[model samples]
Target: MIKLLTSADAMLYREIRLEALAAHPEAYSSTLAREQGKPLAWFEERLTTSDVFGAYCAQELVGVAGFRRVDGAKTEHKAVLWGIYVRPQARKSGTGRRLADAVAAHAATRVEQLQLAVVSENEAALRLYAAVGFVEYGREVKALKQDGRYYDEILMALHFGGQGS
Candidate 1:
């Protein structure tokens, strides 16, 4: 099952987030070193402020994806998708697709475009986003640096016309 997470699920959310950061440091902008010390309240605040969706198997939280609308009036028609992660055991089971669909469906109602960034070397993620109708618009060189190495990112966006214009 996939659903929008609430503040009550903060602890679980933090656990999965830290797991993602640790398991795939190259895929995210945030470092585990920076987030490891954050309190549960920080996760709760995130849940309250953003649209984060959690994927569950039976009772275990196995995946997560988040969407946030741009703040400025001029950018209110756009929203960014972030933090898409699924446990290794949960991969190839459609969990990621379901989470992506949920976020896109929700975003289509609130924004004219949904955007996201994926590491250039992450082929699986690029394919996933492409399957969801996101097209590459540009690339950012050295978008993230970790352990003395720099990584590029592909910026992708899906335009939803006539829905939230």
Candidate 2:
């Protein structure tokens, strides 16, 4: 099952987030070293502020995705999709797709466009976003640097028909 996560699910969310960071450090902007020191209350605040969704298997959170609308008036029509991850055991089980679908559905209701960035070498993630109707709009060189190596990122976006559509 997939559903929006609340502050009550903070501990589970934190666990999965740390796992994602550790398991695939190249895929995310945040480092495990930085997040490890954060308090549980920080995670709870994140859950309360962002439109975070989780995929659960019999009460265990296995996947997560976050959506957040831009803050400024000029950018309010845009939203960002981020922190998408599914457990290795949960991959190929449609958990990622379901979590993404939930985020997209929610974004379509609130913004005219949904945007995300994927590491250029992550073919699986690129394919998944493409399958969800996100089209590549640009690429950023050296978007992330880890362990003395640089990784580029592909920027993608999906446009919804605006507020009334």
Candidate 1's C-alpha runs over 4 A off are: 162-165
What are the runs in model 2 whose C-alpha is more than 4 Å off? Answer: 163-165
Tens digits of lDDT, candidate 2, 56-153? 99888999999998899888999999999999989999898898889999998889999999999999999999999999999999999999999999
Q: Write the per-residue lDDT of candidate 1 for residues 83-103, one digit (tens) a residue.
A: 999999999999999999999
In angstroms, the error of model 2 at 71 is: 1.2
RMSD of each: 1.5, 1.7
C-alpha RMSD between model 1 and the true structure: 1.5
Alpha-carbon local distance difference test for all models: 0.96, 0.94
Model 1 TM-score, 2 decimals: 0.97
The C-alpha local distance difference test score for the whole of candidate 2 amounts to 0.94
